[model samples]
Target chain A: AQTVTQSQPEMSVQEAETVTLSCTYDTSESNYYLFWYKQPPSRQMILVIRQEAYKQQNATENRFSVNFQKAAKSFSLKISDSQLGDTAMYFCAFLTTSGTYKYIFGTGTRLKVLA
Target chain B: DVKVTQSSRYLVKRTGEKVFLECVQDMDHENMFWYRQDPGLGLRLIYFSYDVKMKEKGDIPEGYSVSREKKERFSLILESASTNQTSMYLCASSARTGNSNQPQHFGDGTRLSIL
Candidate 1:
């Protein structure tokens, strides 16, 4: 079974500090995509960063980055220099490219960027 | 820019009432999806359409149905609204690329309250 796990239910970080959100997924497919999505309070979610399993190098988008470990099936998001606007619910998602189009999402981590 | 719009941002429906949540995407994406987001459970896919008038069941498709009469529109229907079904409904669209996982563009979710 393919499942994504976000162990941290909630997290807080001081302004200008960095924090990491943990996510671990179980999948047998060698080639796939992992993504970090941010959902602001009472708003829709948007893609933050994406990483392809085949790439050894991690994916980074501005202050957001992902540590994608294919063998271990772990994908975690790191936020650098947290800002007030960054307060939102962060979700980790996995998508298989095997024509099944099965996308699995984790129970999100609510992140708070404190002043 | 891709714009995905849900008909309503908040909806209230009584028990036993039929409900419809509409989604329209202007990007001409071939794939459309419906998902319910609940606390701790993450986002569970209810249904998805790869083409006009074609839909497939997702992880939790019970108590729900979908229609894609047009390529740009996908509608999720609840046969009978129940309290358990009260959650944030998210509609997403993505281009179908056979070889890679395409990131989904989401609309502002509809928060439905079944009372």
Candidate 2:
């Protein structure tokens, strides 16, 4: 069984500033994937960024990036140059290559970008 | 662009009523997933189908059943809807052949309310 944990329930960031959302997971599998998903007010789930456990380098997508520490079992999401549109509920997810390919998600962190 | 369309954006049903949530994907994805999202709890997988007529139980499958008659459509069913089942239901699909690391495409989600 794998579990993802998002310790921060709520977070706020000023417009154009940067914000980091913390995430941690417990998994015995060595080959796995970590993902960050965003759910806006419209209730659409969007993929923000993803990082593979084997890849030591962090994943970066435009303003979104991930700080993946495999040894610590931590994968955090960083949103740079945050905008009002970035306000959403962010969730961290994990999926192992083997088995059922089911995703395990964290509780989520509600981010509010203030103008 | 991949499109995952859920049948309803919002639905209201009474207790003990049989509820069916439909999802269709434009892309011929090999995998489809059904998840439920609550206020504090993140997206929890209810069921998933790897191929046509092939179904698997996810993390939380109690009180839920699924059907995959075709490759592009996956249906989630609640035999007896209860108040506890009221939540936002999300549908997602992804290609799982050589690219199992691909991110999932999600639907807008169906807000189900069981009263």
C-alpha lDDT score of every prediction, in listed order: 0.92, 0.93
Provide backbone clash counts, one per model.
0, 0
Off by over 4 Å in 1: none
For residues B47-108, could you state the per-residue lDDT of candidate 1 as single tens digits?
99988999999989999999999999999999998999999999999988766548999999
- Pairs that collide in candidate 2 are none
For every candidate, the chain B TM-score is: 0.96, 0.97
- Model 2 regions more than 4 Å off: B99-101
> Candidate 1 vs. truth: CA RMSD?
0.9
Model 1: residue B78 alpha-carbon error in angstroms: 0.9
lDDT leader:
2
lDDT of model 2 at residue A78?
91
lDDT by residue (B10-96, candidate 2, tens digit) is: 999999999999999999999999999888888889999988999999889999999999999999999999999999999999888
